[model samples]
Structures are given as C-alpha cells and as structure tokens.
Target: MDQVVSEKVARDPTADYIAAIEEHGYVRIPQVFDKSTVDTMLDRVSAWFDKTVQAQSARMPRLNKQQPMVYNLQSKDIAFCRLILQTPVIEDILKHFLNDQWFSSVPAEDPNYILRSFLARSSNYQMPMHIDSFIPYTGSYPFIMQCSIPLEDQTRENGCTVIVPGSHKSNKYAEQSAIEQAIPIESKAGDLIIWDSRIWHAALDNVSGRTRWSIIATFCRWWIKQAFDIPGNMPQKIYDQLSNKEKAVLGFCSVPYDDETRGIDMKRSYDLLPEKVADYRI
Candidate 1:
C-alpha cells in the first residue's frame, strides 16, 4: 500500500492532496494557481454570457430544471478552456485521483451535453441534496472526485459548497436532514475543492444578491461511464482528428475478448491495428 501511494507521488509532487482525499475524503487546496488565471476565466465567462444574451435575445432557458439560477458554459471555446485542461494544479490532482494512468479530453460543443458551471444568484437559491456515485454499482474501491473552482469570493451567504464530512465510508446514502452537518467551503477565485463523490453535498442558499460563479470538473476512474456525453455528442471532425491515445481514453478502442484472458495471452495492443490478410491466389 505504501509503495502504491509512493509511486503516485513520484508522478506528481502534489501527493498530499491525494493523501488528504484518502484520509478525509476531501481536500480544499488554496491558491493552486495564480489569481490572474482565475480572473481571466471570470472575464471570459462574463463575455460569453453577454454574447449569449445578445444571440438568444435573452431567451435562453435554464440549462437544468434544478439549476435555474446557474448557467453551464465553457464546455467548448477551446481558447478559454486550454488553461483549465492544462493547468499544472489540475494535472497534479488528477495524477492522484486517476492513479497515474487516466487521460481525458474536453468535450466538444453539443446542445445535448454540458459540464456543471453554476452562477448562483441571490442567497436564497439552494441546490437539492445528492451524492455523485451510483450506489448499486460502486463497489469496494470507488475512486471519484468532484472538483469545484470558484470564480469569485465564496462566502456562507454566497451559496458556498456544503459537504457532509467523512460520509464517503457510508454504504448507504443518507436522507436530507434538517439537522445535517454541512461544511461550507469558503475560498478565493483560484482555490480548488476536491471532494469524494460519496460525500453528500449541495449548493446552499446564496443570500448575497451578487452571483457566485463556479466551474466544476468531476473525474473518476477510466472504467466508469463519463458524466458528459463523449463520442456521441463530440464533433465528428474532432473525433476523426484524434490519435490512438486520445481514442482509447475516449472509449473508441475495443476491449479484450474476456476479462481474465485479456492482456495476458491476447495482449490488447491499443497502438496496433487489426490483423489484415490480403487476398491471394493459392
């Protein structure tokens, strides 16, 4: 167990974040990136929102019924998203969460798919309670993390994330409680909230009239189905242009014929093409 964890840290120096996740099931790393980057994303978000309003004539409906006050944006716009995907802090955190082998690309633009980007308005907008993991299927070693990056100051009155501490070990999901213990995550724009999926959490009321915008990127083991639609919704041009490595992460590669028989005898070569036989006169 020690060696397994040591190997993970070697891949990236930011292993304490992972240790925190293992021990506490969550970690709020402060100042993972400079304030400028966070501010830039906020600016980009504001500009995009303005453009959206003009294009739709202020008629764009709420993305999800539960999130009327929030708008999901920046799933596309590669120029603005490259920073999120390539941020060293994000990579360090992923190194721990994915156990060193996971790789995922940004989803292309599609109306059917969306990543969670919430802009909370009024201290009264409350998010319904939920756990991120699927109870029935998430067996012993369920590795998943919900990463929240605040774009502005998050206060208790600003709809800060509310999480139930040490709930990851629970086998059954708990019901909403009037007496539920909720930990409010307060941070500046550049801070990160990486929480275990098993922990029950919700977006609580933002009493402040100002909007509290947040960008959330949730990641899990490669085997788990992605939260957002991938190839089905990804642009064809984008899919066709990817390399073998990208395709494998995108779930385009074939699995071995059997579970145990896989890789040992068959040795699924992700880089190798199918064996082709040419027609010949015998």
Candidate 2:
C-alpha cells in the first residue's frame, strides 16, 4: 500500500478529494494506508476473530456451538485500531472537519463523532438510511462528516457503500424516488471515502460469497452526540496507556458538551504524540 500511496502522493492525488467533497459532498482518496500495514491489520483482525470465537465456544456447550462471526472494530484487536486512529493521513482529513478543537472517540452529551469498524461477515447485515446529524438538531448545527476506509477492495460485487449524491441537503429519503437515486462507491484496499453524514447511505448487499470489511471514523462538530459512548466503554488502564493527545481524541478530559476551551490541547491529533510527556517519570 505504501508504494501505491507514495506514487499517488508524488502525483498529488489528494487534489480531487477536496474538490469532490466541496462539490458533491463526498470524495475518494485511493490507497491512504500502506499495503503492508493494511495486510498486517487484516491478519491481526482474523486472529482476533478466531480468538473471540474460541472464547465464546468455551462459555457455551458443544451442542450450542454456532457458526463463527466477526465482531465490530471497537471490540476486536483494539490495539490495531488505536494505531489506525492515530495515522497521519486520517488526522489530516480530520483537521478539515474538526479544526483545532480536541476530538475524542468517547461520546459526549450530544456525541458529535465516533470511530467504528464494520465487518460484514454474514450475508444478511444491512444498515438503514440515516444521517450523522443528531436527529433532533433542527437547524444547521450539524456540518457532520463520515470517513470510510476499506480493509479489502470495495467492489460492487462485494457490497460497496451506496449513497445518494448531494442528498445531504434534501428531504427526499421519505419519498420512494430517493431509493432509486443511490450510487455505489467502489474502490480497492487502502481507498478512503469521505462523505457528508447528511447524505442518505446504505450498505449494498454482498451478493458475492466473501465477507466485506471496512472501517469508518466519523468526525463532527463538538456540539453533537456520537453514535457510541467512547469513554464509558474504554477502561481506565487503557486510557492511562494512551498519550495525552490520544486521550483528548477519545473524549477523556470532558464530556462532549463541555465548554470547548476546557478540552485538552492536542499537538498531534492525527499523529503519534511525543514519546515523553513533560511530567513523565520513565
């Protein structure tokens, strides 16, 4: 993947991303992460899935054994996820949406952003139409955005994400015509899809026999609620292991609704923090 991105970067491939999002509310950045890194994550994820299946089996009787399933990203191989969250490319993308404010994975009072992984191991899972905005947010407070990166190539044959172009500003989802206007986004591994959360989107059916895997990290303004409660689920020990910059991104300093000025100041929200803290004893 690195070679792919390095070549794309040399040719300035990101130029289209900004322009596409500005015009159509979405854009695709090909080969965002290096291939080796992506392959490592895939292997790690598979191992994690197998481990979970074994653990679950131990808790149930042999007669009750069921087909193996891959859980969402938040629960499996957390360490690998942490590495992905802190990648520089992802952070650069976040800066466009979040500005200089502290961003975290933990949900605030009105959660604005969430970083989640989705794996379609079964053929039946389908996400419904919904916007990233807080449904109750009546006016223009949303300005929400979502980023989807595929761990595997996203082909129409394998259920790529389908969206309605420019639907983020419309009220058409209630109409039958809206369903007919959807467009599928197809790409290869390491491709990044950034879109307006307000756009009507649904996961396409995976008619192919293989599983589909993707990771999405959503970024929104500080005023909205996240889909998941980040801080509540993250253990204290895990939180302690993170650098202050990561903690800020995970919403540890304050709930999402707290005053913006009260949040931790992250010098590197998209990159790894310095190896040593000012008060470090190590």
Among the numbered candidates, top lDDT falls to 2
Q: Write the per-residue lDDT of candidate 2 for residues 32-97, one digit (tens) a residue.
A: 777987687667766766776655535543322342345445444456446545666556555555
- Once fitted onto the true fold, the runs of candidate 2 whose alpha carbons sit more than 4 angstroms away are 1-16, 51-78, 100-128, 134-143, 171-176, 256-282
TM-score of each model, in listed order:
0.65, 0.66
Model 1 lDDT-worst window of ten: 273-282
lDDT of each: 0.53, 0.54
Angstrom error at residue 178, model 1: 7.0
lDDT of 2: 0.54
Q: Pick the candidate with the highest TM-score.
A: 2
- Tell me the spans in candidate 1 whose CA falls farther than 4 Å from its real position: 1-13, 50-63, 66-75, 99-124, 136-140, 235-282
Candidate 2: residue 119 lDDT (0-100): 34
